[model samples]
Target: MLITVGDDTATFDAFDQSSQVHTTIPCDTSEPGQVLLPHRTLHDVVAKLPDKPITITHMGSAAQFTCGPRTFELPPMTLDDYPPLPDMPPAVGTIDWSDLAAAIREVGAAAGRDDTLPMLTGIKVDSHDGALTLAATDRFRLAHTTLPWDGDDLDMLIPARDILTLARTTWHGDVTIHHDQRRLGFTLGDTRTILRLIDADFPKWRPLIPKDSDTTIRIDRKTMADAVKFTSVLAGDTGQVVLSITSGQVTIASKTAQDGAGEEVIACDTVGNELNIAFTSRYLLDALAGDGTALMTFTQPGRPAMVWPDLPCEEGKVPDADRGHLLMPVRLPG
Candidate 1:
């Protein structure tokens, strides 16, 4: 980590080589020196300090921090030992922070946690037309969302861990993205984040998403989410929950020998034919939590089902290229 202090701003920069996560934050302070400070120690000291203005004065070989009546001195490491920050490459495009953050939260949950398969651990970002599409999958389930953006048609794979961190921490502002062959940069306000792109090729996700479905069900998002949460209690080790749609009702149920069984029925508008499917409760819950749409759509049964906020469309047609979740169904036991 490197800490540089300029006349009007102070910056803290750190990079994790293994995870390829880099973060930079600019502080609103008027300091004019540079120092190398241990991250953990600085965090601990500041956390324990009183909620008052703190003064830090750099000594010859150490720094003194004075908060109210208490004063503490900490030795600083040589700045030369720190690695230099990477330079931002040519700008590929720019996007609103809110849109990028929402997309990350929606799709990042589906990213594979196991590091052995590096490609599945990242999100594939593609820009086309006037929108940016972000997608991720863990084999079992795939999630994606699209938001408006201005950029040339291009694609990049970014580590999910780094993008999620930036999404959660960045302020509400436009994020300028820059990339080259190896590194990707996100600039928000005065803070900039540089992430090393994963070298592996992302899974071919386009074919995995079904273009159309035989069955489509529209239900109240909150009611369905609540039912899933209630039934998940009895889902047990398999963590599987079943959904059966017939007529005007959708039944969410789960059963286990040790935990017994539970079910909740919610009213829904059904189209096509009656269908039944099973899914991992956690994956479904994550998708539900990501979107704020009042109503959600569920399509198909045997294959992956698409779930998205209800779009303003004519009674019988689904919109083309809208933000949504696509979850693969698990085979129910006979």
Candidate 2:
């Protein structure tokens, strides 16, 4: 199929050389099989006609095109010309799409890259004997959950970003994960995405996750989050937001040399002894965003604090309900 660019008064071949990305011009809206330009050739041509229309035609094959002042049609694209579709499982397993997305976001928010930090950008997808375990860590905290899925063989370490993207793009449904050591593929709806898997050995993060805690606090998530965010303004590079919990009120405060100090108090149903805890405002923000508006449960003092969304997050109320986050307390400077 042949495609033309611009009007006959100033017509030119539309082609690019740098990258293989789809390009469309304003006037000529190309249809499905219209070969306006080869993928690689389209890049160079895009800059020239940023404000024009590109028209493509299917010269000798079945083709149709129509759109305002633009059109597109194409000869049949051969199988060899198209990238192969990602493999799909003959039998699929059910997974909560929202939950998987949340898991990736939670881990990505906490993961730190340092000599002391192990790789946390990887999510381990283990089709365990019966359940699929998704786990992540960043030396300071670990996040994990097991979902039911039927599959054989073993585990796959998918890059966290790829899975997060999938979460945003795909809605809940039967998910098929096809993998071949080097890449992980996800099939959802009419789209399929494949990404390279992280091959580094992930640390044994389960042990780092605290099982039992001596102190815990359950409080309104929004109140605490607002307090932290507002007070953190003056927190500077250290960005410290201190949580001082008493029998009745949980106070969040922060101070910096250039900016003054302020505190916000919110009532809470306390558990265990009251204590003072300090955390990076950044970390707490991530935790709060993940907690949504549920009654968040906080566990442990001077340790990674867990935030859990209540039993049922109100409909349309839990924007971030799919996630749970842990914040590590920072040692307040004397």
The TM-scores, one per candidate, come to 0.88, 0.67
Error of 2 at 86 (Å): 7.4
The best candidate by lDDT is: 1
Instruction: Supply candidate 1's per-residue lDDT for 18.
Output: 30
Residue range 219-248, candidate 2, lDDT tens digits: 666677788888988777788988887887
Write down the worst ten-residue block by lDDT for model 2: 14-23
Q: Who wins the TM-score comparison?
A: 1
TM-score between model 1 and native: 0.88
Steric clash pairs (candidate 1): none
Worst 10 residues of 1 by lDDT: 18-27
Candidates in order have lDDT scores of 0.77, 0.57
